[model samples]
Target: MGTKIKISMTAISIIIGFMLAIQFQTVKKPKLRDTRDIWQLREDLLKEQDLQSKLIEEIRSNEDRFDKYETKMKDSKEQALKDTLKELKKDAGQTKVTGSGIVLKIAPFEEAVLLNKRVPEVSPILLNRLVNELNMYGAKQIAIDGERIINTTVIRDINGETKINGRSINSYPFEIKVIAENIKAANKLYNRIQVSPVIDELFVDNLKAIISKPKESIEIPAYDSSIIIQYMEPVK
Candidate 1:
């Protein structure tokens, strides 16, 4: 019985040792399989470093291209916005405009018979009619007494005096600068004003208005006033 017990204990010890050895081999086999020689490890490290460097270079190259693309798009959008703003400024009469046009100068007719009669001052109705006529004949810009005629400009008879842009134009020999679309437009406007019944009526009223031929260039001042947008909004 003692010998059998010792033999059983020895058998148990042998079995435990065998199992431990198998586990040790199982764990160490993977390590041995994964191990590399010294030269091979160095070569693999260099290869990984080269691959990392190449990836970094590729990333930098793509970033540079993206930066250039972004810059180009930004420039293009900025230029487009600038162009739109310039056109808006022009259309709003915020910038001085120069073009080929004509000038209409009006004065009281000098005559002995009309001297005793009250000299007819230019009426607001007459000025309005003249403006409408010029616009009908392709006049692009119109100014009287250095006041630009815009969409919001007001011309009326204020306090028995002709007022343009809320300022009285009570002087004789007043000049009206008209900037037309082109030389031909200027000529057309001039010819229309010369032949219109408004001129005849003015003549009967002892007011003389003379239209000059188309000039090579005529400059119109900008509308120097605050523009208030009361009832406007973007469509989108």
Candidate 2:
């Protein structure tokens, strides 16, 4: 009976020692609690709001850049098409041009008139030759009697009369305006025509080709007639 009492007392002492150890650990390391005041919490909230606002602004900036890029692409395509159409019209002689060039006045030769020789008509062959020579010497545009000479221009005699673009060239002392690419080009054309044998050839036909000095600005009217398109169609 004494031994049983001694064992119960030892068990009670062990239980007390375990309970004291748990209490000592609880005092050494207590749970942490938030000590921040309401003001500090409000400052943190404002910082978060500012970050969110910055993020929204960045997104809007990116959207604006994308929109501008798309608009520029569309505008560039439209501008390219406009430029191409303008170039086509210029090539077709449908637009009036002004540049440096020279002029030619054709009339009866003075010597032929003095000699009382019958003044022959301006032959189509001589006119064609003169035009070919002028084209070879960098003549960009040519207008004979106010008719613009294009790629489809025909100079043929009909009924013993010379007609240009269905208009009669029966009168003398008419003007033939020629436009060059630039002032230097006009000067070059003038020098070439001065030395060309075509001038003498015109004299032989009793026609005088009086060339003028290169001028700074010479105007050439556009082709006034309709251009008949043959064997060509627009793409679908």
lDDT leader: 2
Off by over 4 Å in 1: 1-75, 112-114, 233-236
lDDT of each: 0.81, 0.85
Which numbered prediction scores highest in TM-score against the true structure? Answer: 2
On residues 1-236, what C-alpha lDDT tens digit does candidate 1 reach at each position? 99999999999999999999999998878554667889789866854775676568659966875676567667797765666677667767888999999998988877824567777668888889888767666678999978899888889988898898788898888899999878987887787678766777787678888788899799999999888787998898
Clashing pairs in 1: none
Please, what are the lDDT tens digits per residue for candidate 2 over residues 136-232? 6768899998989998888889999998877778887889999987999899889988877788988777888889999999999999999888999
lDDT of 2: 0.85
Error of 2 at 221 (Å): 0.7
- Report residue 65 deviation for candidate 2 (angstroms): 31
* Total clashing pairs for each candidate: 0, 0
